[model samples]
Target: MVDRCSLEKEYILSPELKFKSEIQQLNNLPKAKKEFPRLSEVPSQVLQQTIKQLHKGWEYFQKRGFGAPRFKKFGQFKSLLFPQFQENPVTNLHVKLPKIGAIPINLHRPIPTGFMVKQVRILRKADKWYASISLQCDVSVPDPMPHGHPIGVDVGLEKFLATSDGVLVKPPKFFKQLQSKLKLLQRRLSRKKKRSKNYEKQRLQVARLHHKIDNTRKDFHYKQAHALCDAGDMVFMEDLDYRITAKGMFGKQMLDAAFGQFRSIVKYVCWKRGKFFSTVDAKGTSQQCPECGEEVKKDLSVRIHDCPHCKYKTDRDVAAGQNIRNRGIKLISTVGQMGKETACADELPGAGVIQSRQVSQPRQGKTRKPKK
Candidate 1:
């Protein structure tokens, strides 16, 4: 579809290549089935869903600046979505599909009450097949309010996370642990002929190892996120993009740390637990002193934070966390009017400065009438 649209202005164009409407695409499915008999094997809805998915990507490309829609190589498109169901397709032991019969599957946990199963997606990873079921509930939940102790977190390759409350967690290098074994498997795979039985077997082994590492890293992230929520009610983190860091010299370590995934998990866990989560400006977080508002410049090699002005010394990461915490507190006070509503006024490092500003600013009351 994209190719056809791109070449629409060309002098010589193929008569068979026409960018059809979605309805026209659906109508042509019968003709397509005649040409490719395998297409008739799957449910019509599933095939329609695939076409809709392609259109969605194209639409997104039109709206967003970059990222043009392209073809997926064989085995790249891994999942099949069943958008709607007239009956409950999942049970304790079996999940029924439209064309395929019931297949035995382990239920991770029973679906909660009052939630209806909206859709099911079947996906394959390594040698195992799995189904991801989507559930919907018509309920409104309020956002968690900012309250209690605030904790700032700093995540890096040195430490998985450092909290304002003086807790430090070391990163568990999941991929590095299995890299040697994975290399051995890949070397053996390279010796085998492509598409041969032994080659396929070796490929599965490599994929399974990668899958295991991903699972381990994800498990660790969740554990750390839950621990953070347990430590404080209000969680603050620096708003730094880890993607840029992933292209630097320590790219592998940055990717292995998976800070972005960890932050997302922390945010979700905070919301689930009714804890407030926020991100502060990342500029000069490590350079600024938490004790005093003076800048103490240091290179990346300097792990220790020694502030000459205030004689404040601590781990650089911990100091960053503390600065993040202070900034978060100040941010909440200014936005939420915590000085009048909460007892956080006395806790701010620059309490006098904040009080002066609060006194100078007028309350946001009703607008006054314009002079005639």
Candidate 2:
């Protein structure tokens, strides 16, 4: 089993650095491209040799029909380009790098059970070196969740998530708290000359602060997922796209909370433990009453749900959770068992055990790759 724990700051830099690096590369491209005019004629060895900090570098190459911008680093790049790989991760995690030697890693979370660390990636984010350990586990996938208890989780912009149990997981406002300080750091960053020693030092400080907020968010997600798992054998919730979208840019609080990360962990852990994990329609989960099965008035400001038709009242999140649980029960049953209450838990051919509750993901979410 290969599991990826995206240390928050590490992820933050991967993209932010990528963006800044793009700007810098564009600035340098005219000169570099002119100098290496006949890049097509360059030898493969020359190509690799010209690339310093190759792993940290990203570029595109083309001659034939296929041309794609790609990362060309050693360890990090190799892991992405190739498939089968294994390496023992450094326990104390400090190994070696171009500039920084073995650095300290505060690995507070427990590593996956009974897996040998295959590789450790030393990356420079804004400041820190996080060890991403790929583990190979001996364990096999788990059986499905029993039908006795099903869960549904509703995700929203106003509320982090509403569970079938009438519970809510509030999105931690991590970044908002540090926004002022972060702004100061960022302002300080802009004041410094680009690539200067002071700029580099300040960048590291910003990276560390970002790391702290991310750490706090990650801890909260783990605790929530663990609690969710204990509530039922199967966990049900929408596979929500918590990322910023065209409609609006998602808030920093959403990113800091990392709801998608928690969902992913819940799915993997549930599968590992033979519990049912699934999702259903998210659009109207909250608008429809779980008790009466009727649409009701709901606003962004309202936390408690009160249905007029059925005289139903519950926390909005909890009501959504119940609806999810109900939907989950129906989803777990295959066609052959139609109308047969006893055969409700019958598993589909590829769905593992009869208790398998994994829902077929909708096409819309397919376009975007899930990131930690």
Candidate 3:
């Protein structure tokens, strides 16, 4: 009964306490019933109860190990989609387990009402206990804006995002903030003897540092992604190449930020609300000129793009964003023209994939806007 003011409780437990207690519970299983008078005297009721207890313990063991009940490397993934299994217990922080009793939720904000309460999941993030309670609610669609008001977003290290509106969101650079602490922890871990308790302790320290880094990076990505989603009538952003592209120093930092995750979440939520999202190509969008259609051979150091023939100069990222928008609109138009639903990735050589290096040959920027 989650009528806004339901059984909402949480608590932040120490890593040592949570780890030690769970490990002990999972490892300490009851002994088999020896000296049974008869199979009937053993009591089928008792046997069933004992089996249930063992089943719960087995689940915990499978998730964490028998020795130190810590999270698995890949973590536990549970979903209530079992075919024959009729019931599964809700993992709320406040929900009492058999014999172990309840673990309270330490909520930071007041729970809202008008939502049908669903099961709560208790998760251990770093050293804290968090209860994620999913509520059943039907949220409606928002008002629509007219066309010609769509947005395009270009992402990079210098600016986290460059929108079609010419707004540049700067990267938060979270790793830079905790550089000293990370360096200290890494150095200490290096100094510790291998396979020793001290080394294991240092490893935990490193893990905590990494967890902190992840949280900070995620926070920034959420703010930026959310803002972009809410602002746009139609969104167009680059589908970043997670592999080979994240090779350089800055690229590595961007990857750590989980750019793909951020974009995916934003896109998903928007799609649910009936909004459109388009992931444009990354190739020539950055290099091609948006104005007079010239290939400006600009280095990363050169922030301002100076088109030689057209004498057009603007911020490189801004120009890039314009190109992304233009390309996306053109691609969308072409798809609509064909009366078919297709993807830009499917855009092949003779298909929608734009080609030629005429901008560099001679007429570079001198030529007026080429036929779109």
Question: Best candidate per TM-score, number?
Answer: 1
The alpha-carbon root-mean-square deviation between model 1 and the true structure, to one decimal in Å, is 10.5
Q: Where in model 1 is the C-alpha error above 4 Å? A: 1-18, 62-68, 336-372
As a TM-score, model 2 comes out at 0.62
RMSD, model 3, all Cα superposed? 14.5
What's every prediction's RMSD, in angstroms?
A: 10.5, 12.6, 14.5
The number of residue pairs in model 2 that clash at the backbone is 10
Off by over 4 Å in 3: 1-93, 96-100, 107-122, 132-148, 190-203, 248-251, 272-274, 334-372
What TM-score does model 1 achieve against the real structure? 0.85
Query: Compared with the true structure, what per-residue lDDT tens digits does model 2 show for residues 203-227?
Result: 8788889988878777766666666
* Global lDDT of each candidate: 0.81, 0.58, 0.59
Write one digit per residue (lDDT tens) for candidate 1, span 13-114.
576976567788888899999987999999999999999988787778878867888777666788999999998899999999999989999999998989
Order of models, best TM-score first: 1, 2, 3
TM-score of each predicted structure versus truth? 0.85, 0.62, 0.58
Instruction: Name the top lDDT candidate.
Output: 1
Point out where model 2 deviates above 4 Å. 1-120, 137-139, 244-250, 336-372
